[model samples]
Target: MFVKSEYQKKLVHVKDVLSMINSGDHVVSGLAGAEPKAILSELHTAADSLRDVSIITCLPMGNYEFFGNPQYKDSFLMEGWFYSGFMRKLHANKNITFIPNHLHFASTKRLDYKVPRIYMGNCSPVDAHGYVSLGLSAVYEKDMIEKADLVILEVNPNVPRTFGDTLLHYSKVDYFVEADYQMPELPVTEPNEKDKLIGKHIAELIEDGSTIQLGIGGIPNAVAQALKTKKNLGIHTEMFTDGMVDLVECGAVNNSMKTIHPEKMIAAFALGSKKLYDFINDNPSVEIKKGTYVNDPYVIGQNHKMVSINTSIEVDLTGQCCSESIGVRQISGTGGQADTAIGAQLSEDGKSFIALYSTAMIKDKTTGEIIEKSKIVPMLTPGAIVSLSRNDVDYVVTEYGAVSLRGTSVRERVKRLISIAHPKFREELQKEADALMIW
Candidate 1:
């Protein structure tokens, strides 16, 4: 048989892919937008025949039956590297657990402990050369694919053909399932007033020719808006979003002045609208490298004037930031925040900024009342995970203003942090600080 014909024999129906599952097998899937829909959506069908099947994923975009149904508890358990709304709402089921790691080592650490039995990744169709592009992400998918005992590619036409370390030969795959499903897209809305002000403050701190790392959020979207006026900015971000597309199209990010990976936009994954997927397709200037290299602090620091812009949920007076959780409950993973923050700080003139609104409007789960709480506090909530340490947080930006705490004492951080807090909470925060002798 010709090579194409030989590889063609691997193509099977989606149900056939499900039959490959075995009891006590561990499975890994691609990140956010690259999540396989048809296969994962029906994995529960095979659960009755299998037991102790653990699935590892990051920011899964779908409410799959395996995750949405509690009946699969004994059959399947999902371990997510990061949590979004889809998995966060299902955390109470007890089948979903969180894995804490920097983006660079998310898969590396896991493999050292347990190598997965299977890897399922979304990919573009095989080309004439029998190569398939690991669309949407190479974050950990590429790594897991190399280690898994069985490799399955869910080939979808909607998947953008991206370049970089994402290409895989057909000979390496055990099976191929032709799946027709819409590619997942993360909705990008316009930033609100508070986010815009925070963006302005962060933009002021970034230099003209700096390389920047940005992730998803209103603040990052706002930062991209405010940065349109900058010149020669380069991207070394973890997620490639529509905001980066805006910057590039507007002539703001030309990648000409980057010290590392100059003239190319490097990211570990792509998660945005169809526009973003279209922009990266067959695009040579953009590279979807694996998370290990893309999010490595040392690699990110090689870029001159590296700036890391991220958002947080809450922060204490000591500059300790909790970006991924609410008290003991895990809200998100400690993805690239710690990675890029420390990496940017390692650069010669790099800066890291953690931006958030001074207060958050939270609906009381018990009383059904809307309560506004200050994000800057004298101390963190009990059991809050410190996603970014005090020593790693260089700049803290709120709508009110920005403060630098790189080498500040606890007392100074307390004062500076309070000064930028929501006005209604300032007096209360100061009183609490005094009572605790935080100063």
Candidate 2:
């Protein structure tokens, strides 16, 4: 509760802050939409001068030009909970540390660590009281700012001033830099016929009064497209995209039937097209809170009829979901998928869905034959991370069918899962399931 100064503030370029950092210091950038691109660029440029600097954060958006380049390979190290395009490129580099945890817990745990410096990012200008809003990403920034020895501010006027717990007292910031650039805009990839069909089938599982938790990419976008006709649909999700705009306009996402946040759209954060960002700007109907509240199992269960839809890289016949890894390789982290799944199960009339395409490839790896490969595996490869266990999954949706496996015995659940798997892989999956004596 420190009082901020309305004194004539001068903007300090990011290079000034970069020069002040010493070797072996821990610096964490604000997560998601609140990422300070200007500061990050400056740090990248100064990588040669700085050494052994550890950066801990979640999926950082936009172009990452100098993350693990050879010129500064030993300079900066990344400790991340999830993988993005940049992380994929640096997968082989052992310098990048991968920590597996739910997104909600990561946001909360970031505070307990020894933070030498914290970067405070914002989109709006200083108010009368000299407070700045955290824009689309108020989600874990408050904690980062509170526990740091030095607080650096990126004052971007173009960042939207979103509502809810998003304000920061200017006095907390040790350095100020004016950076007015448009936030990163996520592009829309149109859905194909197969994707549209999958979306249609998934849409059928959603009722009028269901509150939803969904992830990103074409599948979630396609599913949102099919939900435009549904009535009173509420969104209590981790992140929203451009697809949600249509549902809101059609009066479908009225949030009237939601038992929690009745008139407000509750989300941890958002990353989407420019229009989507502009739509949420100062819009009171939307409440952009921290992930701690939005992704909490207890908060999500307060709503009646909650339906959590998440994607997976693969699912085993025994119902293990590997959303964060490909076999033994760690591709991402166990994010809010487990949080929402468990939350949906605890709701009074809720259902959790693990949806993905039947096949990722159309070639047989062992037989050297042209055949469809199943994303639904007989068993998860060794050391694969299971974000959602069999007991937590309520339903499994594919283009073929939807199987409910919550209360069913292990043998019965295995049979139901194999039945919904791709037709080409059914026989192989059945043989494998039988070998496990599951049926």
Candidate 3:
């Protein structure tokens, strides 16, 4: 192990160390809440002195000067793996580009194209053995740090000391900067009536002792809240959240019956409140593995009775799911929706669910009036990207009801799908289905 004095020798001012970045350098930062705020701020400040500096990021939680200021476009480019609200707002800018990828293969595939010159992220304080934890996110930080030419880290005490593949030796890092900023918190979204209804429908399908995968949002949160009555439920998910913590505390998730990684909650990354951070800090039951292993379908299938519940923007009559986009506009990238959905189906008694509200309020362009429109349309809007294919979907759930599509013909699918659609739209949908000869 490297000595603490040797590691301290490499510590330098954030601005001075970032000044090492040359023009045309490809840089990658720690994603989400794990992003090194101090170092990235310096990079943004130094952008005027550099040109063609491409920064690859995903689910950026903070609004930094680099992304917010249009003047820096000539010097800095933002390439996103997943579009957060900030990235979506910057979509019209020429310097902003979205990279399409599956969450499981995101880091590995990006490195294959072009290895980053710099990999920097925030980490927990160094331990007595000269080891530091990558804090909350281990999604791709470890992979990027291993491939980058220079590795930098910001030491933050607020970051929780998570276990699994998140530990790094001081010797592997080339530079360190002190950062005392608080980790960004994703507040828990209370489940609405519709969300709870949908949750009840999905929860009915989940069996006791089932290992579960949940995405982030009101729907997933509602599902977690609804599952409090379940016994011995386990978690094998991509992103951990506050809701999962509630399950554990409620005595609902003991992980006792999990077929893989028994008695442990396995996840790739986590984002939530300070309460969630405190729960994972040095907790023996939680393991933060890499995305490559955690989100892999084969690994997810190893857990018997796996149930993956993911939200979607819309679904067509054929069961094609459009979760990431609305027509040509990219709202978000394809994360682990397909990964865990397919993986859950591969489990011996697993089930995959796509949940969404039956109706969405949209403003009419011509009339300028807000109207409730059916999300379960006769056909998806033109140019919508299918995040999950028809064959891969097993169950479709709406606040109205839940329908199974597996081994069903197109006619049966159309009828079953229409049954769960908002009642006002069912008549029109049935008429369209009749015209299209779907039934």
| Best lDDT among the predictions, by candidate number | 1
Q: In candidate 3, what are the lDDT values of residues 1-439, reduced to their tens digit?
A: 6587898897978977778898999999888988888877766788778999998998988777887778888889989888888878777777788888888999999988999999989998889888999988888899999999999899999989999989999888999898899889988899999999999999998999999998778999999999999999999999999999999999999999999999999999999899999999999799999999999999999999999999999999999999988887888988999999999999999999999999999999799999999999878889998999999999999999999999999899998999999999999999998898766
lDDT of 2 by residue, 1-439 (tens): 3234432354567777788677898877776678888877767787777788887767877546557564566888877767777786676665677867787777667656565465546556777767777887756677677777877778888878788777776776777788878888878878776668777888898899899877777788788888888999998988876777778988889889999889898888888888988889878988888888888899999999998989888898778898888767787778799999999988999988888888886555678778657888877868888988877888888888788988888788878988888898889888888887766
Q: TM-score, each model? A: 0.98, 0.94, 0.98
Candidate models: Cα lDDT each: 0.91, 0.79, 0.91
Model 2 regions more than 4 Å off: 1-10, 362-371
Superposed model 1: Cα runs more than 4 Å off: 363-368
- In model 1, residue pairs whose N, Cα or C atoms come closer than 3 Å (at least 3 residues apart or on different chains), thus clashing, are none
* Best of the two (1, 3) by lDDT: 1
Q: What lDDT would candidate 3 get against the real structure?
A: 0.91
User: Model 1, 280: alpha-carbon shift in Å?
Assistant: 0.3
- Candidate 2 TM-score, true structure as reference: 0.94
The true-versus-predicted C-alpha distance at residue 342 of model 3, in Å, is 0.2
Candidate 1's error at 124, in angstroms? 0.6
Comparing 1 with 2 on lDDT, the higher-scoring candidate is 1
